[model samples]
Structures are given as C-alpha cells and as structure tokens.
Target: EYVTPGGYELEKILNRGSVAYTHVNEVWPNVYIGDETAKDKYNLKKLGITHILNAAEGTWNNVDTGAGYYTGMDIVYYGVVAEDITTFDLSQYFFSAAQFIEATLSNPQSKTNKTFN
Candidate 1:
C-alpha cells in the first residue's frame, strides 16, 4: 500500500500496477466454488484485472474455481522455482518493472499517454 499526498491509502503495488490480490494462495487461499457472492463482495470485476499468473503447479485447479464467473479472463500457470537466497539476483526483477511502466504509459486511461511528450 502507498500513501497519497493527502494521506489516503492506495492499492498495493505489484509489477508496477495496483494489484487487487496478493499471494493468492494465502489471503483468500482456497478458491470458493459455487459462490458468486464472494466475487461481488471482493470487487474483482471493478478492478479490471484481466490476467492471472499462477505460481503454483497443482494450484491451477484452484484458480479454475473462479473461471466461469469472469468473462474474457486469461490465466496461466508457471510453476515455482526453488532458489537459494545467497545467489539470488535482484536485477532480473527490474525487467518486469520496466514493462509495467510501459504498460501504464500506453494505457488509454493514463494522462501521460494523452499528453505530448
């Protein structure tokens, strides 16, 4: 979460965008089946999230739990990689950050996109 200039709480940042959900397996953990009520309350539709990148293998089924509820949503699963902390490279993550900036600049809703640079 971030604090705006006026101190209002903003959405949490993820890959340079405001993420509606984080650590999908933890917070709302189990995917609820046969329940449209939860989706309505969560406001997932209003958030305009069009993709889901599942970092778990067997958990793909869990995301399927929300399938029919949303239209035109894309979900892809890339299995997690176990790595030692001592050898991790932080720079690799920056590419995603750069891509996020590009996405925001190209977004139709962005004021920056409307202005002439």
Candidate 2:
C-alpha cells in the first residue's frame, strides 16, 4: 500500500491459492521511489522532496550509486534499507486492525548496515 499527502491511498492486493494478502504501508509527506535506475529522482526532486527512502535491497555497490548521485544533488537518502519486519508474523499474529496500523506507522530503524562514501 502507498499513500500520498492528499489522502489518496493506493493498495495492491494479492490473492494466492487460499490466501489473500495486503500490505499496510504509507509514505512520508513527499518521499518518492525512483525507477530501477534513477529516472524518478529528477521529477521527485522537482516536486520539492528533500528526503528519499528506498526500500530496495542489495549490496551497497548496487544501491548506493543512485543514492550517492541523488545525495550529491542535496537530497537526503535514507534507505536501500531492509525489507523485512522481524517482529510481526502474518500467519500467527492476531493483532487488531488498529494495532496493526499503529505498528506499521512506527518508524523502526533498519537492521541492514549502511555504508558511506
């Protein structure tokens, strides 16, 4: 799920076999996800975004090239962070919808190590 500042929430639901799954997530006020390359960075920066959180995963060599390029232009690059939340398990955790939403909204630091140039 992705949400913009205007209260527009976009959700992608997946149905697999006997399971239906939806990820509850939200974006910060003006952060953006770029393409597999860096095309979306320009448009996002033009829209006045000062920080970018990338949820993609890989080696630093793979992730930081784009992050470094964007940071060079003065954007605050936050991720290339980890994708898993180890605290919650989808099959066994019986959290209320509100509780689940609250948990998701909490910003936890990534377990992945970040490298700097």
Query: What's the TM-score of every candidate structure?
Result: 0.29, 0.34
Candidate 1 lDDT, 62-99, residue by residue in tens: 33233344444332112222233447453554566445
Give me the candidate number with maximum lDDT: 2
Model 2 agreement with the true structure over 13-35: per-residue lDDT tens digits: 22223333222111342222343
What C-alpha lDDT, on a 0 to 100 scale, does residue 51 get in candidate 1? 32
Query: Candidate 1 at residue 102, lDDT?
Result: 54
> Which one wins on TM-score?
2
- TM-score of predicted model 2? 0.34
Question: How much RMSD separates candidate 2 from the native structure?
Answer: 11.3
What's the CA RMSD for each of the models? 12.5, 11.3
Model 2 stretches with alpha carbons more than 4 Å out: 1-38, 59-66, 83-117
Error of 1 at 47 (Å): 1.5
